[model samples]
Target: MTTTPDDLAALLASVESDERDLVLSTFTHDDAWRLGCLLVELADERDLPVTIDVRKGPQQVFHAAREGTTPDNDSWVQRKVRVVERFGASSYLVGLRARAKGTTFADQHQLPLQEYAAHGGAFPVRVEGVGIVGVVTVSGLAQGDDHALVTEALRSFLGR
Candidate 1:
């Protein structure tokens, strides 16, 4: 890595414009609110708390709240950032570990990493190779339900 201004500029230019837009556009969608609604519905039904946060490493750009007697998206995102920083690549592994049980996956008969998804909760809104640039988290619900809710919402937007 060089400190030259030209080097930095060249590195920045090396990044594909379309890739940047694809990642950027994924978050800017009006669907974040809709996804928030889905998380809320699941949370209310399960009597759990839900939070949708758009992250760029340790930084959060957008956060939507669904429940809790009080608003605490700020603290929650911080908590998530801490989780990511602490767990690194293993965070998602731990989240899959929190999974309920008897879930099927890559192997014919295998265990999930974390069913509850504690680091992010419920479903995953993360972008692969982006290192958790976004998250949808839930609490007060069973790990299974929590994972289902968040992942379902992710499926909706990620599907389209």
Candidate 2:
């Protein structure tokens, strides 16, 4: 399903406060590894060509299953992470809001496109009382699919 600004807003509202808070509480090297492995297994089962990354600040905690992905996917992950880190929201939500406003993140925020993307698949890892601490990202799927994949994985991981 194509995601609109409203849908993206709902997703952000659903995840940003509640889900992110809970998930970040469980954040750790082991949790990141498990989350990465789960994403890999999901992608493998679905025959998806994707790369998964989970990072805290500048430190990458876990990465898994780069299948049929190129260097471009890595770059996308970086860019999308930049968006999540900068905005403290999901990359797809940012993209949808920008589109709904008839603007692009690059043009609207005067940001470099090469360094920041507004596409999907990167979510802020926000703590309950602490705020954003990291990002979880996926690349090599359609924008909505990438967003959904990360969201679903977070839900499953958090047992929500």
Candidate 3:
């Protein structure tokens, strides 16, 4: 079903809450590995065709792709991750805010679609007080589904 404006409003609010509440006390390389693994496990359990990526700053900490995925998934992950890196927010939240203003994210921000995709899936990896130090991203499902999957993994990993 197509999302109504009220649905969009509620979704935007939920995503904002996820970004705010899903904070790590401190993120290490091990934390990235474990979190990334948890995401992959969740996808595998549901037999999802997707790719997962976790990055700390400019460095890739973990990555995985399910059997049905392709190189395009990698491209999409890169684009979504770029959005989180640039804006310090979940990609879906950015897209929703732009939509609420009756504009596309690329047009509103003057960002090229090729490099920065303000789509769902990429979420900022925020520390308790350090702010966004990395990103966790998933690609392959519908944009909103992709966002939800990542948030679900995060909430599980964080025991929230």
lDDT tens readout by residue for model 2, 40-67: 8888889999989999777999876566
Go through the candidates in order and give each one's C-alpha lDDT.
Answer: 0.43, 0.81, 0.92
lDDT of 1 by residue, 1-160 (tens): 3335564344333322212322323453345556666666656676665565544444444466655624544454455444445444222334443332323222322333232123434222345455335444553334344444555555554553
> Which residue runs does candidate 2 get wrong by more than 4 Å?
1-23
lDDT-better candidate, 1 vs 2: 2
Q: Write down the worst ten-residue block by lDDT for model 3.
A: 1-10
Per residue, candidate 3 scores C-alpha lDDT tens digits across 1-160 of 7878898889888889988899989889999999999999999899999999999888999999999999999999999998888888999999999998888997899988889988899999999878998999999999989999999998998887
Root-mean-square deviation (CA) per prediction = 14.9, 2.7, 0.9
Model 2 TM-score is: 0.85
Model 1 residue runs over 4 Å out of place are: 1-38, 41-49, 67-77, 88-92, 95-125, 128-131
Question: Judged by lDDT, which candidate is best?
Answer: 3
- Arranged by lDDT with the best first, the candidates are 3, 2, 1
Q: Runs in model 3 with CA error above 4 Å?
A: none
Residue pairs in candidate 3 whose N, alpha carbon or C atoms collide under 3 angstroms: none
